[model samples]
Target: MLTVSIWIASSFMGLALLLNLYRLLRGPDIPDRIVALDTAYVNALSLLVLFGIQQGSRAYFEIALLMGMVGFVGTAMLAKYLLRGDIIE
Candidate 1:
């Protein structure tokens, strides 16, 4: 059933999110932490979209889209800062 599938998918995504959180906390290097953070953002986005599908809500989808855009920008800024030691040059 659709409900069962959504539950299973969400469970996997949740597990992945947890692992990403662990990596973000324990990463050995800045780049590793950045990658983990970006992956965590993606996993969170997937979870949000899955929840939206399960709830049959349009608002959740819009929120997820906005989050996705913000996440991308945040990741980009972090990478830029890592490379140049400043976000704005």
Candidate 2:
């Protein structure tokens, strides 16, 4: 059933988010942590979209889109900072 599939998918995404959190906290280097953070956001977005599908609402999808945009910007800023020691040149 579609409901069952959504539940399974959401569980997997939750697990992925947890793993990403662990990596973000335990990463040995800045780059690794940054990557983890980015992945976490993506997983979170997936979870939100799945939730939206389950609830049959468009609000969660919109929120997920906004989160994705913010996540991208955050990741870019982190990468830039890592390379130049500052986000803004």
Candidate 3:
């Protein structure tokens, strides 16, 4: 049962990730690309968490956490750059 649920969730996450990738590549505007990138990271994070749960592994959790932090910072910087044309003021 648990394995079945994990497989279902993984499939959905994979679909979302692919959509985000398409948006990132073909976005008509910078903001659109940024939003797509942000969602992609979030989806990736969820996938990592799901994998960790399925495998009963602690290491994947740490990796997911690390990526979450980095993704947040990167997204913030990108937004700032889009707004002010410079990430650091």
- What lDDT tens digits, residue by residue, belong to model 1 across residues 11-63? 99999999999999999999999999999999999999999999999999999
RMSD of 3: 0.7
RMSD of candidate 2 to true structure, Å: 0.6
Candidate 3: segments with Cα more than 4 A from true spot: none
Q: Write the per-residue lDDT of candidate 2 for residues 1-89, one digit (tens) a residue.
A: 99999999999999999999999999999999999999999999999999999999999999999999999999999999999999876
**Which pairs of residues have clashing backbones in candidate 3?**
none
Whole-model Cα lDDT of every candidate shown, in order:
0.97, 0.95, 0.97
Q: Least accurate stretch of 10 residues (summed lDDT) in model 2?
A: 80-89
Clashes of 1: 0
TM-score of 1: 0.98
Instruction: Write model 3 residue lDDT over 3-86, tens digit each, in one string.
Output: 999999999999999999999999999999999999999999999999999999999999999999999999999999999998
Best-to-worst ranking by TM-score: 1, 2, 3
Ranking by lDDT: 3, 1, 2
Question: Runs in model 2 with CA error above 4 Å?
Answer: none
